[model samples]
Target: MNIKKYILSFFLLISLSLFSQEVAEKRDAPKPEIKISYLDSIKKTFVRDDLASCVDSLWLKELTDLDLYNNLSQDIQTINFDEQVDYELPTEVLKARLQEMDEKSPFHIEYNPGLENIIKSFLKNRKRAFERLMAISEYYFPLFEEALDKQNVPLEIKYLAVVESALNPKAVSRVGATGLWQFMYQTGKQYGLKIDSYVDERSDPLKASEAAAQYMKNMYAIFGDWDLVLASYNSGPGNVAKAIRRSGGQQNYWNIRKNLPKETQGYVPAFLATMYIYEYHKEHGIKPERAPIKHFATDTVMIKKQISFKQISDLIDIPIAQLQILNPSFKLNIVPSYKDQAHYLRLPQDKMAVFTSNESKIYAYVDREANLREKPFQIVRPIVPQDSINTLQRLAQAKVRYYRVKRGDNLTTIAQKYDVAIEDLKKWNNIKGNKVAYGKNLRINGTDVEQKLSAVAKVEVDKKAVIKDSLGSKMDSFYVVQKGDNLSAIAKKFNISVADLQEWNKLTNNNIQLGASLQIAKNSIKEDVVAAPERKDIQYVVQKGDNLGNIAKKFGVSLDDLKQWNNLTTNSIALGSTLIVAKNEIAIVTNKAPVASFKKKEEYSAPATEYYVKKGDSLYSISKKYPGVTISDLKKWNNIKDEELKPGMKLKING
Candidate 1:
C-alpha cells in the first residue's frame, strides 16, 4: 500500500466513526449547517451504524401506505411458521446445524425427521417471508433480549417469539392467542398482561415480552426440559403431562412426541427450525429485508388525557397505520384513561418533543369536537365561540338558554314546543333557513315580545318554555345543511340518492342553504305526529365484507359515533353478530370536517432555509407559511414521496 494514501484512508474511517457517535443536535436557528447532500453522503458511507448499533440494518426507503398497514395477518406471514411440517431435507446437513444450535442452547440437541422436515419446508416455501421477519426482528429482538435477561431465561428463547409471531407485535392466532409471545387470553391475564375493552396489553411489545419471559421462567420450573417447555407453551402443561404419561413416563421430547397433540407434536420442531434458519440465513444466501424504522428511533410517553389515534395522527401528521404499528395495545385506536391505568403512546424519538409540547393542544382539539362527530377517522372541528357573553344571542327580553340539537329536531317542531314562530327560531340564531344542525347548541326562546313582562306574561312564558324543554326529544330523521353542503354531498352523507333527498324535501331545485333541515327518513313527517315515538333499537348484523367504517357508512353515521353507540373499544367486530347501529335513528348524525390552521409567516433573508415540522403542520401548511414555497417544492427538496408528514421531521424550504 502507498504510505500517504493509506494514512489518508485511515483518517477518513476515524472521522466517520466519530461522527456516528455524536448525538445529532436539532437546529433551532434559521439555517442548518448540515446540508441535504452532505447528510446523504454520510448516510451512504456509514450505513446508519453511526446513529445506533442496535439498528444498523438497511432501512426500507419507501414507507408506503401498504407497508404502514402491513401486519402479520394481512399476508399470512406468521401462518407459514405455524402450519404443519411436511417436507424433507438432507439428514446430515440438518443434524449438523441442529447439533450446533442445540449445543449453544440449554435445550435438548437431538434431531429427528420432524425437525428436518420443518427446516426444509420453511426454507423452501417461506424464504421471502422469513427474510422479512428477520428484518423486523432487528427492532424486536433487542426488546425480547432485555426481557429475557431480566427474567434469567436463556437468550436462545428469544427465537420462540419469532416462531410464534414472525416478530409481528399485532399477530393474533386463530386459537385466540395474541401478541409476539402468542399468549392465550387466560394465560395472558395470569402473566399480568391486561386485557380490557380499551386496551389489550398482550399486543404491547415491552409488556408482552416481560410477561412472556416471566411465563417461560415459570414453565421451565414445571417441565425442567426446554423441549417439553416449548411443547407445553404451544398446547398446555396438562396436555404435555398427559402425553408423558401416555408414553409410559418418557422424559425425552422425541420419545413422548408421538403421544402429544397433533399440533404440539410439531411445535418444538418448528421452534428449532426457526432458530436454525435465523442463525444460518447467511449460509443459505437469504438476505434480511430492510427494516422500516429502528429500535432506538422510538420512545414512549404516558398519555395524560384520553385521545384517539386518528386525532394524534392528524395533529402530528403521522399516518394512523404507523400509529397502530407503534402502539398496538390501544384496542380502538383510542388511548383511554380509566382511573389509575396507565395508557401511553410510542412515537419516533424526534417527534417525542413535538407530542409533549402539543399535548394540551391535541387534547383541546378533541375536547372542542367531542360531540360533533363528523366523519369516521377524520378530524372534525365544531364552530363554537369561546362561550363568551358577547357571542351569546342578544334577545330583548326573553332569557337565552342553549338547547342541543338532537335527532329529529326541526325548526317547526322546536317552534311548536317553545310556543314561538318558525321565523323567530331562525332569527334568534342568525339562521338562513328552517333547518337546525344536529349536536349544535340552539338558542331557544330568543324572541322578545315585551321589554318588561308582567308577572302573568312571565308565568306564561315560563310554562311554555317548560313544555318545550319537556318535548325536546323528537323522532324526526332530519339533517341540517351545513357550510359547503350541496344536495349531492348531503345525499351521500345520509346514504340517500340526490333525487330521493329532493323528493323527500319537495324541493323545486338542487339548491340548499346552511341550517336548512331536511327530513331524511321516509316516515319522518307522518300525518299523525305522536308525542313520544317508541325508540326501537336499530340493530345491524355483521355481514361478510363488513367493517366498522363501512357499516357506519351504511347507517349514515360517523365511525366514532358507531363505536360510541355500541360502546365498542376496537374495530374487530365478529361476523354474524348484531351491533346496535342506532336507537330510533336518534344519535347518529354526521357533521363537517375541519381544515387545519396555518402557521405564522416569518420573513426569511436566506434563499434556502431549514424548517422543522411541528404538530399539525402539513405540506400545504408549510407551503403557506413560506410565501414562495409550494407543496411540490417541499416534496422535491426533502425527497418526500408516498410517506406522509411526521412531526419534528426536517424539511429544506426554498424561497
Candidate 2:
C-alpha cells in the first residue's frame, strides 16, 4: 500500500507540473468577446471593398460544444471553453477566438507582429495579417534565399525572421534587439553589422539577411546540429553550451532542451509554428494581399560627398519610405561611406534615368547645406601600428605626398617641393583652378599608395606642425573651454593629430575639463566666428529624440567633431537640453568652387533628342551636333549620367 501510494503521488505531481506550464501559457489569454453586429459590419465591408466575402454556412455548427469542451479539457489550464459550453456560441465565441489569438499569438507580443487590431469581429483581421505576410514574402524570400544559399545555410532558417520580427524592419524587442532580424546592438556588432551615429546597417534587409545567414552558419559549424544551432541563435551559444553541460554533455538539442532557458524552450516551437504558417497559409484561410515589390535596377554611387535622406527624397520622386526601405543602414537618415567611401543606391528601373541626369544637381544641393555647419568633415586617418618602425621610416622617406597648406605656402611652392603637376593636385582635390584653403591638406601624388603612405608619414609631422603652428600664433590665441570636448574628435576637425592637440594644450590630465579654457593660438581661426550668446560654462539639456547627429547638426557641427570638442566616449545623447557647442564661432568654407554647369543640359536640338526630352534618347544625339560622334563618342563627350535620356536636352557632339 505504501508503494502504491507513493506511485500515485508521483503521477499526480507530474500531472500538476504539466498543468502549471499550460496555465502559464493560458493566463495571459482571455475568451475573446464576439459581437454579431461587428461580424455583420465586416461582411458588409468585405463585399464593398470587393475583398473575400464571408457567407455564413452550417459549417459554423461543425465545432460543437462537445468538441470545444473536449479541446478545452485536453488543455485544461488553457481558456475554459468547457465551462462556457452552450448549444450556439453567441457571436462572442468568434470574438473570443480572435481575442485569444491576438493575445496568444505573436500579434500582441513585445516582438512586433505588424499593426495591431482587435480582429475578433471576423476572420478578416487574421486574414489581413496573413495576406500582408504573403505580399512581403515576395520581396524577402528572394533576398533570404540568395544570402542563405551563399552561406550554405538551410533555407528553412529564413523563417526565423518571421518569428523574430514578422517582417517589420523597425521591430524592437523588449530587450532591445532591433531591426528585421531582431539583433541586439552588441550581438549585431559582433556579427559585423555597423551601428553608428549616422546609421544602423543591421536594420537593412540585405545586410541583416546576410548577417543572419552568416551567424546561423557559424552556429551550425560550432554545434554541427541544426536544432542546437537554432537554440544558440535564440539564447546565444553560451547558453546552449551551458545547457549541454548541465545535461551531462548531451549533444542533441532536444536532449538538452529541458535544461535550456525557458524562453529558449518556447523559441523552437514558435519558430516551427511560424514556418508552418508561412508555408501553408492558404490552408488556414489566409490569402496574401500582394503589395508589389518595387523593382530597382541600381548601381553603386561612390559618394565621397556627404548627403542626407531628405536631399535624396527631394531630388528623386521616390518617397522617403521607399528610400528608407531600400537602405536601412542609414541610422540618422544619412548614408555613410562604405569601405570605398561608396554607397549602393537602389534606383527603380525607370527612375534611374532621372537620377543619372540630375546627379550633379543633387550633389550641389547637399554640398551647400552640408557645409553650412561650423564643423567640417573630419578626415579620420586609419591608425598605423607604432611597432612598424621600418614602415614608418619608408613612409617618412617617401617625400611626404601631402602638403598642408600654410599661411605662406602657395600652389607653386607646394607643387615644386613635391615635384608634382599642379594641375593634377588641383583636379584631384576638385579645386577650380587656383582656389585652395589655407589649412587644407592637399594630395601631391594622386596615386592611392602614395596618398596612403604620405598620411602615415604625416602622423609624426602633423603633431609637430600643429604645435609649431600653435606657438607661432600665440599672440592670436585665447582658450575657452566648454562642456563635452574630446581630444580625438576635435583633432580630426582641426586636421591635427590627437597627440599634437594634447601637446599644444599641455593637457597633462588628458581630459578637457569643463569651464577650463584651453589655449588657441593665431592661425587657429580655420573658420569664421558667428555671434551667439556665450556657452557660459553651463550644462546643456538634451531635447527629446535628440541623437548625437541631430544635436551636432542643430549646433551646425559634425558628430565626430562634437565628440572631440566635448570629450565623449559614446555618441549617446538623450532628449531635453544642452551640449557644449561652438556658439561663439562657426567654420565657414569660402574657397569651394561656386556651383558650375558641367553636367546639366539646358538645350536639345535633334529628332533623337526629342525622345531624350520627352520619352527616350539613344547615344546618337551627340553625333547630330558635333558630327563624326559615334555612340561611344557621345557617351564620352557628354559624360551623361546614365545610358538613357528623356526627351529634350542639347546633345553635345563627341569628337
Candidate 3:
C-alpha cells in the first residue's frame, strides 16, 4: 500500500510538471502577424535560379519596414509601415472597394498578339525603370489610396499610374500627356491643376492623385462601369464613348478596346500586367531596388517671393538634386508663388529648423542674386519669363503699385516683374501695345477705381516716363521647337496656315530637320541687311605709313567696308598676308587705278599737301593727312555735320 501511494504521488508530480511546461510554452509563443500575399506564377516559373538562392528571390517575404521606408529616411521613424500593413481590412471594406472598382474601371483582360507584343517590347525596354517605379511607389501609393477612398473609387486603380508614367513624376509622353498620372494640359487645367512657370501641380503626387480620383469619379458617372471608366481614363471619355457607340453601346471595356487608339489598346493590358507584377513581385524575381529617397522625411514652408533651388542648395549646402527631388514643380529651378503668390518650399525634416532660421536670409539672397544655377530635371519654361509675374492685366487705382520698367523692358517683362500678366496689364492700361519702354513708370497694382482715376485725371506724378517709339510692329507669332518637332506643330503656333509656314520656309515636303531655322512670318521690322562690303579682288596690304582711310580710298571702297570684310571681330588688320577680299574669279580694278603701286611704295611722304572730301565723306578722312589731327579739330575749322563733308569739298590741311 505504501509503495503504491509513492508511485501515484510521483506520477501526479510528473503530470503537473508537464502541464506547467505546456502553460509556459503557450505563454511564450509569439502571436502571428497577419501579412497580405498574392501568388506570382510568372516570376516563379520564369526565374531559373537555384532553390538554395530562392530566399534571395523572396523579395516581398524579406521586405521590412526599413525596406519600404528606405526612400524616406527623414520621415522613416514617423511612418508606421508595419502598422499600415497590420491594419486589418474588414471584409465589408474590401467588398465595397472592389465592387466600386468593378463598377467603374476601364481595363479588360484580352489576348491580342499585337498588344501582347507591345507589352513585351515595353517590358523589355523598361525593365530597369522598374526600380524607379518602386522607389516612387512609396511616395505616390498612399496619396492615391486616400484619394480613391475619399472618392469611393477602387483602390486597385491606383496602379494606373504605373501604366501611365512608370511612376516617373516628370514623364512627358509623345501625346503631351505629362506627370505620373499623364494628364493632358487642358484636362489637367480642367481638373484644377496649376500648370505655370514655377509649378505644375499635375506632377505633384498628392495633387495629381486628387485630380485623378475626381476624374475617375467623373468617368464613372458616364460609363457606370469600372472597366469603361478605366478605358475612358486611358483613351479619354470621348474616345471611349465613341468606342462604346461603335460597339453598339456595349458596356464592356473589352468590346470597346478595338475602337480605342493604338496606345489605348495596350493601355488596359499594361495596367493589368503592372497590377500582376506588383502583386507577385516576389514570384517574378523582379525585386524592387529602392533608391534612397530623402524627401520622404520633409517639411514644407510657404515662400512669398520667387525662390530658386540653387538658393536653397547654397544656403544649406544641400545638393540641387536633393532639392529638385523634394520640389519637382519648380520649372527653371524657381518655385512660383502659391495661390497667395507664395511658393511652397520643401526641405528635409532635420533641415527644416535650419531652413526656417535662415528663411529671411534665404529669401533675401534669392531676391538679391538672380544668377542662381537651375536644377537639371526642372520644368522647361513654356512661356518667356515663366517664373516672373504674369502681366496679363493692368493696374487699377486702389490696387495699383508703382513699378519701374528697366532696360530690356516689355509688357511680358514688366508683368513678370510685378507678378501680373501682360494681358492683364493691357486690359488695365487699355494699351494695345506690349512694349514697355525703359525708365517707364508702370502702375503695377491697383483697383479698378484707381485705373479710372488715373485715366480721368491723367495723373503724371513725377516718375520716369516710358518712351514708346510707335515705330516698330509686333511679331506675328512664335513657336517652341520640341524634340521630334515637325512642321505641323510649328505652323500651329504662328496662326498662319501650315501650308504658308511650309511655303515661307521653302520646305518642299512635310520633312524638316530639328533645330533648322525656319521663317514663320515676314519680319515686321525692316532692318537693313547690310550686305557684307565687297572685298577687293586685288590684294593690298598696309605699308608702314598707310592707314585704313587712304587704303580704302585708293581701293575705291569705304573704310567701313574694309573693316567688315577681313573676318575681323575688331578694326585692326594684319600688315601682310592675303585676305579673302573677293572670290578668285572676280578681279576688282578701281575706276581710279590698281592699289599695287601705292602698296609698293615703302617710303612715306611726310604727309599729304592737302585733303579733299568726296560724297558721303567725313572730316575724319581729311584729318588722316596730319598725324594726331582728329575729326574734332577738323570739324572745329569747318561748318560741317560734325565731321560730315560733301564730295569735292576742300579741307585745310595741317600737315
Candidate 4:
C-alpha cells in the first residue's frame, strides 16, 4: 500500500511540471501587431482642395457629358428601347443581375441606384457605343491583359482604359493629357514614355499599356484598396487623401465618396458600369461589331533607318490610314532613328514576308525621295497688288532682341522686364515650365515700352562696348556663362564640345556658375598655326534624324575620339555647325579609308552575363538590369542597331 502511494505522487508531480512548461511557452510567444492599411494612413494626412488643383476641369466635364458617348458611336445605329426585353427589366431583376456579377468578378462590383442607372443607360440608350467598345476591346483588351499580367495586377483593370480613352490610341484630354493612358507630359516622362518631335510613345498601344500597368501597380501598392486606386487614378492621390480626412477618418471608398471631387465620385461608378455592360452585353441584345484588326493579325519589325509612313504605304501598297492606325506613335508620320538605337515598325501579319523581301528596295526608295526633296521648294506667290504694298508697310514692324536672364529671375519677372505676357515669353522661347536658369538667353520681342527705353539702352550699350574694348582680343573671344546655359547648349552655341569647355574651365561636374568666363577658341595664340595642326574644322549640316554616331562613322573616327577632340559631353549637335575633326598631322597613304573598329577586348572589364529577353523588354529597359551596362554598349556588343527586343532572344549583359 505504501509503494502504490509513492507511484501516485510521482505521476502527479510529472503532470504539474508539464502543465507549468506549457503555460510558460504560451506567455513568451509574440502577440501580432495591429496593421494599418494604406487608406488609413492617407486619412491621417488628408487635406482639403489638395487634389482639386491637379485635376483638369475640362476632363471632368467631358467625363460627365453623356452626349460624348453618343457622338463617338455616330456610325452605328442606336438600339431601339422597345426592342430589348432586358432593358425593360424591373429594378429588382437588374439588382439581382448586378449581385450575381459582383459575386463572380474578382473586382468589388458594389450595387447602387447610381451604378444601376449608368448600366441601364449604357445597355438601353447607348447600345451602339457599347457595341463599338466591344469591337475595339477585341483589338486592345488582349494587349492590356498581357501588360497587366506581367505586372501581376488584376485583369479587370483593362476596363479602366475604356473609361479613360474609349480605346482610342490618339485620345488627348483638354488639359494636355495624351494617349490611351491619358498621361501628362511630366508624368509620361517620369514613366519612361518618350515624347519628342517625331515619336510620342504614350500613344503606342503596347508601350502605353505597359506604362499604365506600372502606374496602376504603383497606385495599388500605396492604397491597397482597388476602389481607392481607381479614385486616386482619376482625381490623384492627394484628393483621395483629403476626401478620407473629411469623411471623419473613413477608409472605405463609399464612406468618403461625399468628400471626394464630383468627377472622382462618379469615376468608380462609371468603371463598374462599364465593366458590367461589357460582361453582359449579349444579355442586353448588344452584339459587337467586327473589328478592323484582330489581336494576332499584326507583327512588328525593327527599322534600322529613319523612314516615313508615306514611303512605306506607297512602296508596300498599304493604305496610309491603315498604317497610321497600326502605328500611331510616329508623330509627323516619321519613324525616328538614332545612331545607337532603332525604331519599331508594325505591319499586318500577312505583309511581313513581303516587307522582309523588299526591305532593301523600300529603303532605297526612301533615300531617293529624300535626296530629291533636299532642294527647297520655292512657292511662287501671286504678285501682290501694288495697292496692298502701302498697307503692308503700315503694319507694325516687330523687332527682336536677345535678353540675358539674371539670378533671382523667373518667367514672370522676365516677362515684366520686357513688358510682355508670360504666355508670350513661353511661346517665343519654347519654354515649358515656369522656372528659368541664370545666364540663359531669352529672345524678347521689342514692345512699345522697350521702344521708349531704347534711348536709355543705347547709353548702356555704349558703356558695354567700352568695357568690352578694354579687354584684350583673347579675352574678348571668351563667352560669359548664362543663367540657362547647359554644357550641351553652350557647346552647340560656340561650335565646340562640352569636353573642351570642361577642360578649359577645369570643371569636375556639368554645373557652371553664372558670369563665369569660358574660353571659346581652341588656341590661346592669335596665330592659327599654334592650334593643333592635325585638327581641321569640317562643316557638317545635320540632316533630319542625323546623330553624332552617324557623323563619327562617316568620318572614320571613334565616337569617344570625336567627343574628346571636340570636347563634347553629349552626342547632341546643332544642325549646320562646323565641328573640329582631329586627324593625324601626318597623312597616311592608303587607297581605302580606315574602318572604325571596336576597342581592345581587355578594355571591356565587365563579365558577359546571358539574359533571355522577356515580353515588354526593350534594349533601353534591358540595359537597366546589369550594372555598368548601357544601351549603346549593348548595341555595340550585339551589333544591334534596332532597339526592339523579342521574347526568348538571348542577349549578353556585360556587368
Candidate 5:
C-alpha cells in the first residue's frame, strides 16, 4: 500500500507541472485586442488628400536620390509571387494584430482605414520595395537601434528612416534635404555634420543616425508624445505647435490633425503603417532579400592622409564602389588628405585586417602615384606689371560663357572656335587631357573676334581653316592621337578638315589608331576676305514629339529658317519623317591649304569576353581586361562596397 501511494504522488506532481507550463504558454501568446474607440476617432478626422499628398511627396523625394538599384519598380515586379499567399485579413483582424503588437511599444499603433490602406498598399503593391527595405534594414537598423537605444529613444523610431530615405544613405530630397535621415543643409550643419567638397557627413549612416537620434530626442522632449514628435519631424515643431493652437489647445495628434500640414497629417499614419507592416510582414509571406553587406560586417579606420577610392581599390584589391558605399561621405571619391586631423574610412571588417597589414605598402603606393601626378602640365600666363591693370582687364574682360562639349568637340577644336589657345582652355577648365566629355560644360572666355562671329560661322571657318592648313608649312605641328580619337576630332584639334586629313593620310576610310602620330598645318588665309557659307536648306528627320520651335532651337537655326526650308504653314511636324532646315544665313570660312596626314591603324585588341579572378585580383588587375571600365565601374557592377574579390569569382567585362 505504501509503494502504490508513493507512485501516485509522483504522477500527480508531474501532471501539475505540465498544467502550469500550458497555462504560461497561453498567457504569452499574442491575441487580438478588439478596441474600436481609437479607430472611431481616427475615422472622424481622416483626410485622404492630405495623407496621399504626403506619401507622394515622400516617395518623390525618395525617387530623386535612390541610386543603388536601377529600375527598382521593375526589379520588384520580377520577384516571384508564388510564395505570397493571397488572403485579405479583415480590418478588425489587422487592428487586433496591431493592438497586440502595440502592447509592447511606447508609440500608439492604432489601426484605422487610412492606416490599413497604407499597410495593404505596401504589402500588395510595394512588396518588392518592402523586401529590399527589409534586406537593407539588416545593415542599417542595428546602427539606428544602437544610436536610439543609447539616447533612450523608442527603438520603433528607426522606421522613420524608411519613410525618410527608403534606406538609401545618399538620398537627397527635392528641398535639398539629404541622407538617410534627410537633414537639410542648415540642420545638418547645425548638428555638426561637415559639408564640404570632399565630404557630406549628412550621408554617413552612423554619424547621421546618431544626429537623428539626438534630433528625435529633442523633439520628444518638447512634445512629450511620440506621434506629435513624428509630426514635428515631418513639418517642424513650429508647425505642430501652431496646429495644436489652431485646434483649440488640443495636444492630441488626432485633434490637431486637421490643422497640421497635409504632409504631417499623413506622416504619422505612414509611420504607424510602416511599423505594423515591418513587424507583421512575415505573416503576409514577405521575406527579406539578402543585403549586400550585413551589419557588423564592416569596420572603420582613421585615415591620416588623403587617399582616393581608386588608390585603396588598386592597392588592397578592394572594389572602389564598395568603398564609396562604405564611405559615402567622401564626395569626389577622395579621402581628403588631412594634416593634424584624421578622417575615418569604413571597410568590410575582413578587408580592415588586410588594410592594416599592408598599411605602409598602401600608403607608399598612393604617395608614389601622387608624386607622379603631382605636377600636371599647365600653361603659365606671362606676368604683367601691376600698372597694366587696364590692359589685363580688357584682355580678361571675359564674358563667362558656358559651352557644353558636343560629341565631336576636343580641346583643340573648342579653343580654335573660341579664338583661345588650347592651353588656355585647359587652364580655365582644369582639364588635364585633350579629351572633353560630352555634355560637360567648358568655360569659354570670348575674345573680341569670337564675340563678333556667329557660332555656326565660327565653326565653319575653323573647320575650313583646319582642312586647308593640313599640309601648310607655315603652321606645321605634330599630334599624337589619344583614346577616343577620330578624324573629325583630330581635324578639329588642328583646325583642319576631315577631307584634308583623309587626303594627306592617303586613306579611303575614317578609321584612326590610338597613339598614332599625325601632322597638323595652320590655315594661311587672308582673314578679312573669308566668306561665310550661304544659307541653304538641310534635311532633318522629325523625331517623335518634335515641334518646329524645338527643332529650330536644337539645330541653332531660326524658326523662320525651318518654316522656309520645309514650306510649313504651322509649327508642327510628323514623327519619324524628314523636314528640311535651312542653314543659318552665313558661315565664315578661312581660305587655307591642307597639310595633315591621318595615320594607319596600329595593333589594337578588343575587350575580353570573360575574366577569371586570380589569386590577387585587384581593381587595377581586373581593369586591364576591359578597356574603359574604371575601378568605379567594377565596384558598382559587382556591388563591391569595400574589398576586392577572392580568386575564381566571375566579373563581367564590359567596355
Candidate 6:
C-alpha cells in the first residue's frame, strides 16, 4: 500500500494528523454528511455555457508543455496496428467468438480479417502492456462507469479512453487533443468543460468521462449507430457522413470502413481489441497488476479557500506527485476556490475527515507563508526524490556481490570467506555490532572499500547498527539527538549509563538542542543487534490513516523500539506531524512494483521482427518500442560494446 492508502486504512485504529496542534477541531468532530453521490453531483455542476466563450488569451498563456513523450495512445494513433502484431489463432475460432461478442455489444463486433489482425496484434505484442493497462484501468474504470452511466452512454464505451489516451489523464496528442478522452480545445470548450490558467477539465478523469459520454450521446443522435458514433467521434460526424455517402449510403460501419480516415479505421478496431483483451485476458494468461490505490479507496472535498498542492503536501505529508495524480485537472497546481462554484481536492477516502478538521490550519499556513514572503508568492518547491526509476538500478550499478545468510554464519565468517574486513561488512550492510541476522543478504567488503550502498528502502533502512567504541574507554560512536528525544532515551538506545552520557558531553542538565549531536560509547554494543538512524532525518508525519507497526517496519526499526523511543504507553503515536522514521531520512519508494508476470510473462513470447533505427533513436527507445526486447539483447545482437547509436542503425528484436 502507498502512504496515502496506508495512512487511510489506519483511521479506525487512530486519527494521526488531527491530533497535531495544526488541526483546529475536536477529536470526535462530526463528519459533514454527504447528501448525494459524486456521480449525481457532477451533473448539476457542469456549465451550460459554450466552452469557447469561456476561454480567453490568459487561458492560452498558461499552457504547459505537451506530456506526449512515451504515451501509449500517441504511439497507437501513428503506428499501423494491423502490421504491428501477429497471431495464429484459427479463423473459425475467432469468427465464432466475435459473433458471440457481437450479439451482446451495441457496437459492431462482427468478424473481419482487419479486426482479427488488431486483436491478435494486442495479444501477441501487448500482453504485458495490456496487463499493466488493466491494472491502471481499475482506478479509472469505476469512475468511467459511474460517469458514463450518468450520461446514458454504454458502459463498454469506457474502453474508448484506452484507445484515446490509454487511460492517462495527462495525455496530450500530437494534434493537440488532450486528457483521458482526448478532447480537442474547441470540442472540450463546446462540451462545457472549464479550461483556463488554473484549470483544465479536459484532464479531469471524472469530468472528461462525463463529457465523452455526452459527446457519444450527441454523435449517436446524428448517426443512430454506436459504431458510427465511435467512428464519428474519431474522424468527426462529417467525415463519417462522407464515408457513408461514399459507401452508397451504407449504415453498417464495416461497409463504410474503407471510406473513413486512416486513424479512424484503426481506432474502432483498437477499441474492440481492448474490450476483448480485458474480458478474455485470463484465457491468454494475462493478469492485472493492480494500481497503487483503488478508486473507491479515494474521496473528494470542496475547499472553502484557495489551496496549493504544496500546502496540502506539506501539511499532510503526502507526496506532491501523488496529489497531482489524484487531482490532475488543476493546471497551475492550485485548487482555486470560486465564490459561486465549488472546487474540491480529491484524496484518499480516509483523509476527508482529517482535511476538513484541519482546513483552517492549512489556510492559515498559506496566509503566514504569504505574509512572510517579502515579494510575490514564490515557488518553494520541495526537494522530492525522482522515485519513478526503480532501486534495482542502484543495486545493479553498485557493482556489488550478494550472499544469502546461512545458518550459524556470522558477519565475521562471511567477511573472512570474501577476504574482507569485519568492520567493512558491518558498514557495508549497515549492521550494528558483530551481530548479523539469519536469512538476510549481507554485503561483504574490505575496509579500503566505501560502505553505504545508497541506503535501503521503506521496507526498512538498517539504522540501529551499533558503532563500537574503537577508542575502548573513550566515546567513539555518535547519536545525533532527534526532536522529542531526552538524555534518558538516548542512553537507553545506546545501552550506556546516563551518567556516562552526561560526563562525555559535559552536560549538567538533560536539556539539549534539537540540532545537537552527542557521541555515544560502544560499551556492550557487541550484544546490540539493531541498526540506528543517521543525519538527513527522514521523518514521515503520520497522515490521517497510518499504522505504527507498518511505519516501524518501513523505517527498518522494531515496533517495540518505536514505542519505547516515543515514550508511548498506548498504541497511539501520531502525537506530532513528524513520523520520526529514522535518524537518516530515507527516500520515498512506491510500494507498487512493475508487473513482472501476468502469469509469468516469460511463459509467453511473440515472434520478433527486425527494425532500422530512425533519427533520435537509442537502444533504450528501441527496446521500449518492442515488448520483450531488452537493451542487453540489443547489445548482444549488434555486438556493440557501448550505448552509442546512430541513425540508420540496423537491429534485431526477439520477443
lDDT scores in order: 0.65, 0.54, 0.55, 0.65, 0.66, 0.66
Question: Local error of candidate 5 at 212, Å?
Answer: 0.4
- The estimated TM-scores of all candidates read 0.49, 0.41, 0.45, 0.48, 0.48, 0.47
Judging by TM-score, tell me the better candidate of 3 and 5. Answer: 5
What overall lDDT, based on C-alpha atoms, would model 1 receive against the true structure? 0.65
lDDT, model 2: 0.54
lDDT of 6 by residue, 166-249 (tens): 667787777889898989999999999988667899999988888899999888888899999999999899999999899998
What is the full ranking by TM-score, best candidate first?
A: 1, 4, 5, 6, 3, 2
RMSD of each: 25.9, 32.7, 29.1, 31.3, 30.4, 29.9
lDDT by residue (174-205, candidate 2, tens digit) is 67888778898888998888775666777778
Which 10 successive residues of model 3 have the least lDDT summed? 458-467
How big is the positional error of residue 604 in model 5, measured in Å on the Cα after superposition?
64
Please tell me which predicted candidate would have the highest TM-score against the true structure. Answer: 1
What is the total number of backbone clashes in candidate 4?
10
lDDT of 3 by residue, 1-655 (tens): 9999999999999999999999999999998976532212211222221211111223322221222222221221132212222222243443444345345544444444433343343344444455556756776687689888999998988888766765666667667888768899999999999876557887777788899999999988877887777778877788987887899988777777778876566566666656644654554355676634423566798877766676666565566666665666666787765333456777666566666765666665665565455422122222223111111111121134566555577787677766677787877556777676654456654443233322222111100011111234322222335567878766544445778887776778988754355666554212221111112233443444556665555444566666667655655666754443222211111211111221232322232235576654545434432323466656655545554456787775433
User: Model 2 reaches what TM-score against the true structure?
Assistant: 0.41
Give the total clashing residue pairs for model 6: 18
Segments of candidate 5 deviating more than 4 angstroms: 1-87, 374-655
Better of 2 and 4 by TM-score: 4
Model 1 lDDT per residue over 363-461, tens place: 666776575665322112112111111111111111444566677988888788767888877876889976777656576653331221121122222
